[model samples]
Target chain A: MAESMTFLDHFEIWLRAYLILSLFSFLYKDNRFYKLSEHVFAGLSAGYYVGLIWQTVIVQQLINPMFDEGEWVLIIPGMLGVLMFARLVPKWSWVSRVSLAFVIGNTAGIYLMNALHGLIFKQLYATMGSISNSNGFAGVLLALVVVVGVISTLVYFYFSKEHKGVVGVTAKVGIWFIMIAFGAHFGFTVMGRISLLIGRAEFLFYEWGGSLGQIF
Target chain B: MRNTLPVIIAFLAGIAMVISFFFNPERTVLGTFQENLLQWVTIVGGFTLVLGVFSIVRVNARAVSRRSDGWFYKLATVISVFAMAIPSIMPTSANSAFGKVFYSIFPISWAGAFGTGPDSIYDWLFNYVDSPMMETMFATLAFYIASAAYRAFRARSAEETLLLITACLVMLWRVPIGEALLRSIDVRIPDYINMFVMNGFNLSVQRGIIIGAALGMASMSLRILLGIERTYMGKG
Candidate 1:
């Protein structure tokens, strides 16, 4: 709690309280207050980012090099960057595809090998190592549970063949694993939201209210 | 020419990138080309943000000009955009014009009051306006999601019953209240159950999903490279 309150502190607290209540208004029903806050938030965020990007990126990275240091080689990509604006002009829009294709192709190419190594190989290796490290009957049981869950879950998502009989049974088992995972995710998400709610409530009840109390 | 040229460009770029990653030796021209392309892509990405801002302005401006439903909201949006931008363009000190304007209007200060610098207005709006709104919006989602889960989480079959039981156990194991409730019944629980059953099971299943998704991504990337996925080039 801030004891020696300035007018700015009170002003900020009031602004925050109004925004919080305005957003919560949507829980009851969508209204103009919420709409106003939502739009203002969106605009402020986009505008703030524009400012940040200009300072950190455009000035430091692009402009400083071209004008101050005279690295004219940067102009090729700079030209490519300008071509992105061609989308606004329908006739010249195809020029933008060169830029987009370069991005997509490069990103896809980079991630292909990266994902294969990171996700597939590493995960498989870890699972196998875990199974190997397990000891005793209980450890074996746990290992079995993991193996079955993974295999069945993979089978459940296999879209090529129609699920029936043995395949159907395996997929059915897979659904249980998937549902449980979903429920766990749901629980975690709820807790995360509740934690944020508590933080806001605490600020409203203690800090904001306490600051106001000091003035009176 | 428009369609084919871009596709060819994509194929060449993708192939060069992939080949450079595996086959290009250190200090080779191919490696240098790969590095330069990566930098160029990042610069181009920044330009895309400009395109994004332009689109937002165009759309909101139209909504305001047309006097469409909730046109005032759009007006507010347009106004805030410029309002936020103005402060950042000027020096952010209490002595600076932008800072002076905010400080005189608000005139409130305490420990670490932020309206003293070039970023003063932007910081004020972000902390006071955006932070509260964004947090509360996400917090509100908790109630709706819980409601949705309650309605949809029905045990309709044997598999579903297994799901329900596992879910309940995992959820219970995760929270203090759930642990306290279990402890009250004189049934002592070990961390092993949480470790082996909940975490182990969840990790294995998630790994399966990760592997599947990785395979899908690789295949999709291949498609994009080969021009099978032409949706990015539009005509979709």
Candidate 2:
């Protein structure tokens, strides 16, 4: 056992277990350690994203043009970025409006071109095919179930307020269909979450335990 | 006025966007419009970042002025944001640079490097750090569930007894023991008293729970959208 497992390996495993189990301790009651861990996690994540945006977008999109190839088109956005500083000043902050419009327009432009191809139109086209295209009998049933589930779910949100009478009854039934689907989905999610915890626990038990754990 | 105007603009922009998808307006025309809008989005988003950067500047400036502890962190953060943003377009690493500078970063295929550099740092963080943490956060529901079961699974009245019985069956069926104890773990209709009946019951029960959960989520989202729920905004 000692031969197979290094001391550092054991220490690291236990460290993860301690952090995870300590996080779980918040369930019993709020505590300082949980807060500390949560805060650390937040700060870490924020820094991480900013790093990514820097690497992926800012560097690729902005700085590369400035330094690397001297592509002046990139400088337009750069100038616009500088223009955004208008917000800092009292009278001239409205100068940022030009910048804001550029951002909105660009996003709308991209999404307008790309989003429908992947999401709505494409998805609808795929689902329009026969249910047999689904893998098995169960899969076909599941597809049908999903369609009905989605429709019913939508009905549950039919909040025009005036939607009552006969349609109201149908809407209520839709709500039930949606409710059942949601409940089943929740159970699945709960199982998934529990599975994650169990997986972590297994890591602690098997990985951290010793060479005996390695054998299995 | 600050928030309201943006919301209105977003709404109008969204409506045009919806039309653009189906219409497929002439490329030369739409492309120009789209290009113009893309530029606008980039600019506006950058300006928005100015608000963000200014806030960062304030804290750091205050810190530098007051000589506060950890002021250097604020300084580092500001400097890093700038460094990362500048030459952000530059080839800090091969993957980062898009144009010709990116093309010549190295002869070796980046795939060979596999797990290195800023991209890899992000990939690693997301996989190991973010995924596990998210899973861990999700896993925490087990404790709440257990406590709820303990208190809620009591059989005080007839209704309670019925509820307890169903919940117990559900709990059993959910675990490994239920299939083991019932005999013939495989599918069969041995008796209405036995396997088939229980399976049907369990399937329906699970299905119902799934639908309820989805509605719960939808209700919550709708509430937030309608301004009925504002906890996310921090203090209603």
Candidate 3:
């Protein structure tokens, strides 16, 4: 397996190792190497996104159907799409507003209904259902915690109600819940970072260091 | 005419969209209208992306021409953009020599993960270069977070102490080592505690925040529909 490896194969793995190390160098201090890598990444991302947008959207969705398939009715939307470029012309900038208005209105309208049904009502139903369906003592205990946690967390965000007496105590409980939740999120993030580190280590030892590892 | 017209259009479009969503899964007249409107938005969104690419080119070109502080990097950026984009613009047939070469160079397993065709130069650049750089950039955040945690996680008060303890337990519970350590002690700690705290309490709190944010979204949408929030319409 080692003898069959080509120069290009070795070069690729080593280069990847070098780049990974260069990126890790930022943890020590931001240097010229890190800056180069960062700029390269930014440029590549912009280019990649442009290519992606063109392939998935413009040529496939717009040009293919409109020009090739002869969808004449699509001319209205096609014209609207072209108007987005009006922003490039100083005198015709106002023409872009028509497109922007449509985009924003449609987005806001879709999200409004989605957030209501998908997030608010669905979550409310799930929370209520959990309490009734809870099986054992532990399950019952968890249901209670969930109920209290939700109520208190909501109370903490209540701005108009002056936090005093019952509200004050509930808000205090809410803060505790929030802190614990934040802690769990942080723990998960730490695990994610560790996993990335492990991946880099695996590459260095297994793929890049394969020949070296075999030698040792 | 410029300002008032857009606002009116926004209001009409917004109301039509909401009315359509109320129609649910089945095909109604309004639902059909909404679907068409959505398709139009998708097409328009593509143009905005091209606009984005132009903006990047314009900015970098100016920086290069004017000999800005990091003009060398900006030049590099511009060069890299064209380098990645040009090769990607060429369509490669699956059965071609280039396709076979790519298949041998990049295994199907890796290519599949990256969601690219065999001969896609875009896929090659993304897999070998872009993903590593982006991952390392974000990985740097982990180090910074660790340092910050060390400084801020001091158990100076009761609340702070509780936070510190919870953070430690939560972190420990995620790994096999933590469970092993507990097992070694001959003390059986129920896994339910971890699940109850994280999944139940933590999730409930998140739901609360989500519901609150949804309410805020609805309110803002209403304001925008009513023309009360004209900031999106741009400067006066």
Leading candidate by lDDT: 3
User: Which lDDT tens digits does candidate 3 get at residues B1-236?
Assistant: 88888888788878888887667635677767777878888888777887887789889989999998989888878887876776665434324455577667765444432223554777877877888778777777777778888787788876666667777777777788986775566555427537676877788899899989998998888877777877876654
Task: Write down the worst ten-residue block by lDDT for model 1 chain B.
Answer: B110-119
Ranking by lDDT: 3, 1, 2
At residue A94, what lDDT does model 2 achieve? 57
Each prediction's DockQ?
0.56, 0.16, 0.59
Better of 1 and 3 by lDDT: 3
lDDT of each: 0.77, 0.51, 0.77
Candidate 2 segments exceeding 4 Å error: A1-15, A80-100, A105-154, A161-163, A211-216, B1-135, B148-236
What fraction of correct interface contacts does each candidate retain? 0.59, 0.14, 0.62
Q: How do the residues B35-104 of candidate 1 rate in per-residue lDDT, one tens digit apiece? A: 7777777887788887887788789999999999989999898888877765555433455454577567
What is the CA-based DockQ of model 3? Answer: 0.59
Model 1 lDDT, full chain set: 0.77
Could you tally the backbone clashes for each prediction? 4, 46, 0
Better of 1 and 2 by TM-score: 1
Judging by DockQ, tell me the better candidate of 2 and 3: 3
lDDT string for model 2 (B5-123, tens) is 44344445544554566655565466566554554455346445435645665766678678787555555545544433333223433544354465475554543222325445445
